[model samples]
Target: MASSAFSAAKIVGLTGAAWLSGTIAAISLISIPAVSRTLKEDNLSAAHAVKLWRNNFEAGFALAPPIALATASSLASCGWAARNLRTSGVKDGRLFWVAAALTVSIVPYTIIFMKSTNDKLLRYAKKEKLTTSESQETEGLLKRWVFLNSVRSLLPLAGALLTSIVVLA
Candidate 1:
């Protein structure tokens, strides 16, 4: 095992990736039924449905900045590690991305998962507040996000598998 800080960061990051990926994948898989349940009739008047669409869109929009930040941090960390191989900070290459992704995803992922409270989203929710009613309306949207996150989980696992094959074969 690496030193305490190093290992802890790695574990925190990897755990976040696994969780984010799993939840994203689950969301992506189950989004359709959610839509159907919400609008029994396919045809939604613009005024009636706009709020719902925007709410979900707001959820995604909320996520975008964090995703951008997380990706940037991971990529930047990887680049720095590559330049300074002797340092005891983050290691080089995808490991850096993975670790950074994990460490960074914590708050954003938590915000999405912990629908029990909307204080975070509500703080930013425009127009009407993030009422408890929003949870039911937004579950599918959040689920889709989680499903996409699953793909992220799979990527690191794939990288590790390939590395193992090369070393042990």
Candidate 2:
């Protein structure tokens, strides 16, 4: 039963990590660029871009915590189990530890690097009127946010890939 439970948790963690990575990739590769192009067109489009950004931000924020928790929990549990089993060589747990670190690091990464921009974007979104300068400023912020987000997206992808390799090995 314990083994089964571990397997189940590993599956859950892998799935969550994959989903999170994919979402981040989509946001970085597709959504941000699309919205940015819209922003360049006109004020109405800028407002629409803001709306889309807000929705994407909220959805990502909502999903990240739970996925991080599950990934961390499963990785930790697996790591502990692997240690107890006295597996040979450093690679036995090395990948899992790296995966776990990357998985949990997303929290601090988001808080430290992404939160201020997220807050500013949220504030900008709430504004009733934005001058051309303000719109340009917001676009600049969005560009920074997208770049930071792209970096963040890589963490989970690497983590997930490492974790999968660990499991397969």
Candidate 3:
């Protein structure tokens, strides 16, 4: 059935997108702090710091496209799901199960922010003790990662909902 195809495709697409985004977030958790510490450890002049920062920005930009693709898939999935839901007499069980799966998938995206959030809250823990240059750099890197990751998660969900509205109309 065409409707069933749409539902199945949506689930598949969302699953793929969630996994892809989660993987990227995991990698960033590992890499952001390392890169930040490395940058600070160089102890370069201000000009060199500027250069390094620019390079890092460029690298992040380069990584953005695949992330975009992952999000796009979610958007598409949302549209598919919404379209399927528009029809009357659909089984509530199917819809409920899909919703449950989506809710579960969201856990990782939410928790991925935990480290950055914890770091922010724990700033008090280290306030009395002066953090090293490397520590400060790591914090900065973690901040950027959080910002980007937040954007990554929010935008896709927005796009998906937008698509659903547009398509369902």
**Reference-based lDDT, each prediction:** 0.43, 0.77, 0.46
lDDT tens string, model 2, 47-156? Answer: 56777899888888888877877787787776666655543222466667778778878788989999999888888788776677777677888899899998898887
The ten-residue window of minimal lDDT in model 2 covers: 82-91
Which lDDT tens digits does candidate 3 get at residues 10-34?
5554454455455445445655445
Candidate 3: what lDDT? 0.46
Q: What C-alpha RMSD separates each model from the true structure?
A: 9.8, 2.5, 10.2
> Which candidate's TM-score is highest?
2
* Model 1 per-residue lDDT at 38: 52
Residue pairs of candidate 1 with colliding backbone atoms:
13-102, 21-149, 21-150, 23-146, 24-146, 24-147, 25-146, 25-147, 27-143, 28-147
lDDT of 1 at 84: 53
TM-score-wise, the better of 1 and 2 is 2
- For candidate 3, the 10 contiguous residues with the lowest summed lDDT are 88-97
Per-candidate TM equals: 0.39, 0.87, 0.39
lDDT of 1: 0.43
Quote the lDDT for 163 in model 3: 34
- lDDT of candidate 1 over 1-107, digit per residue (tens): 23443434334434444444444344335543444345455643223333544465456447644653554353444444443543444344454554454435545
